[model samples]
Target: MIKLIAIDLDDTLIAPDGHLPEENVTALAQAQEAGVQVVIATARGYAGTKRFHDQLGLTTPLIVSSGSNVIEGRSGEVLRRRFLPLPFAREVVAFAQAHQIALRVYVGNEVWNNLDYDPSNGRQRTVEKQVEQMAEALVEAPFQIFVKGNRESELILAQFGEAGEGYCCRHHVYSDGISELNILHPKSTKHDALAGLCAALDVPQEQVMALGDSKNDLGMIAWAGFGVAMSWASEAVRAAADWVVPADAQRLTSDPDAEVAEAVLRHVLHVAKDKKSS
Candidate 1:
């Protein structure tokens, strides 16, 4: 029996228009009622993921910042956090300056972003305090560092990623055609964080289900005993999934993007229904 579910938010659970689909809402509520743990695992901050946790009435810890930060849901306690080491973080700041690469750095709850505030363009919220000099604002080691643009830039971040400098890297592109590489502590993966949460909850890996759509989600999806990938996910991601949401799963949701509803309902809940009927 699947007892825990880790769900990615941006492209998997939330539609492009930014609304949670009606069917998804219903299915998650039913899952919670069925005593299954519904966890929101996203590459966003706690401030960004909290509203959904509240809406779903989930009491589980939230995996945020692509697993860099895990916080208790109800009391907002810091369950676990792995931040970039200060020396490496300072090195990153200097390197960004040298390459003129834009940076978004997280220092605890405060953020230092060089980008303009444009929520209309799908940018992170305006809560990020605009900073001209990253070195000046980065008082503490960052939980995550977002380097604008994809492709390794002259090995600036290779030390952290490919070179294995105690950090992990992820490449992601937004719907607006902008791409970024997120750098964080080496253990900062949804899979690693989920493993910790499962241990705490006493849920075996075999009883954990994970759903997602992006390559960043690949770790958790591949690690979960029963992994679900959206039908439109890349071939690599799909290959890792235990069950890829079929093309017909789109019909299970009014919002084409909330295919998670189908995975949750048919694969998770339908079994319960059948057992009761039997």
Candidate 2:
């Protein structure tokens, strides 16, 4: 039987404008009431995702920073953390600086960036500092580095071929034509973090359902027992999912009565109920 549900934040759970669909909110409450554990697995940091967690009243540990950090939701205690080596972090920063690309470095609870304002498309928890100052402040390894620009991720990958040997990289292109590059330790992935979470919860991988809509969410979608992809997801993401939600079900609208959330949750609830019955 399904015991856990891992949902992504952007596009999958919330509308493009960043509002949670009421249908989704009600569905999530119903799932919790049914005793199924729900957790958020997103590339967002704790600060970016905290509001939704609070809104949902989540008590489970949250998988943030694309799985580099997992913290207890209720107590705000760090449960697991993985960092990229200091040398790699330095190399990545220098490379971004040379390319004039905006980079955000996540170290513990603070987000360090060279830009005067948050460069991660309005993400929260940021502190502006010069690249040199940010590099020097890396007393320990950072959890992850995010690069934002119009450049394709493959270009960055090729440039870091040798330097990023031990690191893992993923990219997501937004609807507004901006692409983001995420650099992290090789072992830090949503799938790896989910494994750890499963271990802690005594739940098997086959008993979890994962929902997402972007390339960064591919790992978890493929790893989970039942993987769901949003209708507007990229071809690559749609191909990887076990099920694909229709566009009508995920309409891009400002309507408060939109049923995107309800459509997504109904499928999950049906599968969970079937598992229990079987």
Candidate 3:
């Protein structure tokens, strides 16, 4: 029987407009009431993810920064963290500065950026400080780095042989004109983090369900006992999922929030019942 449920944030749980549907809220509440551990696994930082955790009143630890950091929700204590090696981080910073790529570096609780702030960027907190001297400012190893711009610019970042080798890189296309490259330690993956979480909870990997909608979500989806993909997920994401919820079924005639809630509730009920009967 499934003992844990891990959900992705963007494009999976939250709508494109950044709103969490009421349906999803209710379904998750029901799951918690049923004694299943719910975990939010995302590429977002703690500051960005805190609101969702608070909204759900989650007590379990949260997987953040694409699994580079896992922290307890209520107590706000860091459980695990993987930081980029200092030399490698410096090399990445130097490369980004040389190419004039707009970059953001996450170090502990702070975020440093090289670009002007814009509300539409979707980053929950404002950049704490601007890196005037990228090299000097990046002395400490960062948990993650975000590079934003066109594909060509991100491709340029892929050239740092050894420096890039030690890190897991994810490319995201926000629009025709905007793309983002996320860098984290090679070991920092949702699957790895979930494994740790399961061990802590004394649950097996086969007793966990994961839900997601993007390439970054593939690891956990593949690792979970039951992996669910959203209807609008990419072809790769769909292929990785054990089940796919059709867009129409997810939304029905209700709002996106309600649709998500209903879909989650239906799936959870069926799975739990099946497990019990078997």
Candidate 4:
């Protein structure tokens, strides 16, 4: 039986502006009231995602920095962590330097970038504008403008290839056409985090329902018994999902939050309720 519901942040669960609609907020309350576990498995770190839990007034634990760590959202206690080996960490940094690509590293909740590539540099006026726009879009983001480098796409790929499961990488296309990449240790994936959460809660993967809308979310989507793709998810995301909500991104944005939340709630709650009834 399903005993837990894991939601992704970003475009899947939050508005484009980074705020949870009142309707979604209420739906979360209903899930909690039903005694079903409600939690988030996100790419965000503890500091970045805490506000979502707070906004919903939820006290459940959170899986942050992908699956690299599980934390107590309220107390900020790290319940568990999986870190990259020291050698691997150093290699990743070196690869970025070699390729002349910008790299952002997440060691715990802190982001470290190469000194020369810091986003604050006046030389990166174009990249800086994109960052500014994203910051405005999300209202809040985890990065704090650390070191930066020239675009080194080749080196970044090599790092991930050599690093293997030792680390994870996320590629983002900036509005300025610059590609920004982030790398973290292996455990920092939604799949691993979801597995970790299942173990902690004594819920089987077959009993979990996950919702997402991006490539980073692929692992968890495949890992869950029921994977939901948003209405506006990419074709790859839709292909990976067990079910697709007819509502795409535009529809979700234009439709009421309550409507979107209700669609998600019905599917997840049905799974949770039926397992118990069985």
Q: Which candidate number would show the highest lDDT if scored against the true structure? A: 1
Question: Which residue pairs show backbone clashes in model 2?
Answer: none
Q: What tens digits encode model 1's per-residue C-alpha lDDT throughout 1-278?
A: 78999999987888656778877888898898998999999998888788999988898999998998889988778899998888888788777766566677888767776555422223555635767676766677888877655543335546555435677667666775656678889899898999999999999999999999888789999999899998878888899999998876325445566688878887778744344355
Model 4 regions more than 4 Å off = 95-103, 108-110, 116-150, 158-165, 172-178, 248-260, 269-278
| Higher-TM-score candidate of 2 and 4 | 2
Across 1-278, the per-residue lDDT of candidate 4 in tens digits comes to 55677888877678555566776776667777777677888767788899888887777799876667789989999887776655655655555455444444444455555533444343463331222122122222222112233345444555454236555556654224455455556556778877877887798888777887777788888888888777666788889988777653323223453333644556644434344345
The list of candidate 3 runs beyond 4 A from truth reads 115-126, 161-164, 175-177, 249-253, 256-260, 271-278
Q: Which digits, one per residue and each the tens of the lDDT, describe model 3 over residues 1-278?
A: 66788999987789666677776887788888888889999988888899899999788999998899999987779999998888877877777667666577887777877654422264554655877686777768898888766653455556753235677677777424477677889888888998899999998888888998888889899989989887777899889988887665423325654434544666664434344345
TM-score against native, each model? 0.86, 0.84, 0.87, 0.74
Error of 3 at 259 (Å): 5.4
- Candidate 3 lowest-lDDT run of ten: 250-259
lDDT of 4: 0.63
Model 2: per-residue Cα lDDT over 1-278, one tens digit each = 66788988887788776677776877787788878888998888887788889898788999988898998887778899998888878877776666656677887776778655456655563555544556556677888888766563556677785235568777667877776778888777888898889889998888888888787788888998888887777888889988877655434333533333544445546634344345
How large is the C-alpha RMSD of every model relative to the true structure?
3.6, 4.7, 4.2, 8.1
* Model 2, residue 176: C-alpha shift (Å): 1.3
- Model 1 gets an lDDT of 0.79
